[model samples]
Target: MDSAPIVVHPPTGSGGRRVTVRGEILGLAHSDADVVEFLRRAGLPDAEGLLDDSAWVKWRGGRAHHYEAA
Candidate 1:
């Protein structure tokens, strides 16, 4: 099994609840670059302030995408 870890920091001054976000991606059915590109295309920014744990991962010819949070 292959797993990757990502970290994110929630935005401030958004008038919402604040929280620290940490994500663990396990068993991605593709290369790390592909998975990262997929996440990036799905509006998951590669910056702090984006929800790292709650992002879409599209796989299998872009037919399936799952959202996971931790």
Candidate 2:
């Protein structure tokens, strides 16, 4: 099976959802450029999504897009 490592960092004072793939930072996990491009690169098209808006602690891995609030 093919799998990709997706890491998410909680947003800062004026930042958006930050994510990493294979240990490389990918900007915002909730943005079209970052997270969307990531899913396409990982070949998980249907896994695109946004994270919950309540807390800053979220999932660490998935074909799905995950993020944390600041």
Best of the candidates, TM-score = 2
Please write out the lDDT profile of model 2 over residues 1-70, one tens digit for every residue: 1133655655544545666655666566565456667656766564454333213224444323433344
lDDT of each: 0.31, 0.50
**Which segments of model 2 are wrong by more than 4 Å?**
1-4, 30-34, 49-69
Clashing pairs in model 2, backbone N/Cα/C closer than 3 A: none
The lDDT of model 1 is 0.31
Worst 10 residues of 1 by lDDT: 56-65
RMSD of each: 13.2, 7.6
Instruction: Give all TM-scores, in the order shown.
Output: 0.26, 0.45
Worst 10 residues of 2 by lDDT: 49-58
In candidate 2 the C-alpha lDDT for residue 20 amounts to 63
